[model samples]
Target: MLERLQAALDNNDAQGFSRELGNIAKLRSMAQLAKDTGLGRESLYKALSGEGNPSFGTILKVIHALGLKLNVQLPERTV
Candidate 1:
């Protein structure tokens, strides 16, 4: 799952990112995913469909629900 997300990030592709989000099984059914994200079904459709802009908080909840972490990678020279 992480690998798929990483690939999407590497490609900077929204559709790929969204498809990966949609693929999360542990996050529960699509309806549940929508409820957990505090977004309506259509909104969830747009969000994970990669067509709508979602709030950071909402995205955070989705990521958290997926048991994933958002992190920063410091450049080696920054140390």
Candidate 2:
């Protein structure tokens, strides 16, 4: 699921990506995401808006808040 979400985000498919993130955030109140992420509600709103730019840490917290984990992977090499 996370992989699919990441693919959507990487592709800049706003609708799909936003839907995924929104579902996760929906688990908690916007205020809760704000408090837990240490970002203001307004900031959180912007960061998750699909057009907003946020630090990697902020993105991580939002993912964590949504019970998701980010895994780092090396890119495949061309032969």
Candidate 3:
């Protein structure tokens, strides 16, 4: 799931990111996740539905709430 999310971010795929987030949300209730992330349930849903553009802070909150860490990797150079 983390790999999928990372790939989505790397590819700038909004729908893919939302899909991956939805998958993770399925593991826990959206309401619970919202509470954990200190975000409103409706707002969270909207943001993760691939329709709304969520703020970076919101994304960070969600990632941390899900017990996930964000890391940076350099792109491979082609010979």
Which ranges of candidate 2 are over 4 A from the true structure? Answer: 1-4, 9-19, 75-79
After best superposition, candidate 3 residue 57: deviation in angstroms? 0.6
The TM-scores, one per candidate, come to: 0.68, 0.65, 0.79
Best-performing candidate as measured by TM-score: 3
lDDT of 3 by residue, 10-63 (tens): 998977787688668757788889999889998888888778788878878887
Off by over 4 Å in 3: 77-79
Candidate 2 C-alpha RMSD relative to the actual structure: 3.3
The order by descending lDDT is 3, 2, 1
Give the worst 10-residue stretch by lDDT in candidate 2: 14-23
Mind giving the per-residue lDDT tens digits that candidate 1 earns over 1-79?
Answer: 7799878977877677776776673357767776766667676666775666666676677887666787867757854
lDDT of 2 by residue, 1-79 (tens): 5665887877877556665675567657888887777778887777666667666677788878766776777879999
Report RMSD (Å) for each prediction in the order shown.
Answer: 2.9, 3.3, 2.0
Q: List the residue pairs that clash in candidate 2.
A: none
Error of 2 at 42 (Å): 0.9
CA-lDDT, candidates in order: 0.70, 0.72, 0.82
Q: Rank order by TM-score, top first?
A: 3, 1, 2
